[model samples]
Target: MKKLLILVFLTLPMIAFAQTKPYLSIADAERITAAAEAKAKAEGWNVVIAILDDGGHLISLKRMDGVQIGSIDVAQAKAKSAVYFKRSTKIFEDVMKGEGGSRIATLPNAVGVEGGLPIFKDGIIVGSIGISGVTSAQDGIIAEAGVKGY
Candidate 1:
């Protein structure tokens, strides 16, 4: 029993350390935003991009000139939904189009829109990015570019 207790105590810290998740850094967030911005600029689209950490905390936000002011909140909501739900916002948008999908609207902070994607590192979600201001499909394209940057 003494040996077993010592082993358990010795391994506890390793277990805790192994469970620590990777997080999005400020530099990574900035890189993602820059990539998304480049895509938007190349396509001549004015948009708002929002990046969130694994905990759904805002890391970065960019609203291009001529983008609607309302898109700021929408972009953040999309990013938050992606991080909190661990999936693309497009899934919710698609579900909302189906019958009985109105229930999705009841979920707090859920945005039924495209352009939100969970950023992955080594198959684990590290963060998310959301874009707004252009068409949903276009926003999705920009978001994809941002995630690819990371």
Candidate 2:
């Protein structure tokens, strides 16, 4: 039992540090926002876009012309969900539609939508992007464009 406990303590930090995901730099966040905005403009879809670090901290946010004000909050919430959960908001959205989906609704700052995506580098999630204002599908497309930059 002593040896097993020692082994467990030794491995705990290794397991916790296994995720070597890098933090997003301000420049990187700016680039992501620009890419997303370009995509939205190209598609003529006015939208709000948000970028968040791995810890769910907002890095940048942009509200395009003609976008609804409410989209600002929604976009941030989506980004928060993606970064905190290390997955796309689409997953939560799909799960929420199932028999037990309502349980997820109780989670704080959980926005189950299709416009959030985790930004990965070298198979590690570094950050996330969220887009709103247009339809969920359109917002996802724009967010994908942003994630491609990071």
lDDT of 1: 0.93
Q: Looking at candidate 2, what is the lDDT of residue 144?
A: 93
* Candidate 1, position 142, lDDT: 96
lDDT of 2 by residue, 1-150 (tens): 999999999999999988455678899999999999999989889999999887888889889988989999999988988988888898888999999899989998778889999898777777899999999889999999998866
Which regions of candidate 2 deviate over 4 angstroms? 1-21
Specify the highest-TM-score model's number: 1
Candidate 1, superposed: residue stretches over 4 Å from native = 1-19
Task: Give per-residue CA lDDT, model 1, range 53-106, as digits (tens).
Answer: 888888999999999999999999999999889999999999999999999999
**What is the Cα-based TM-score of model 2?**
0.82
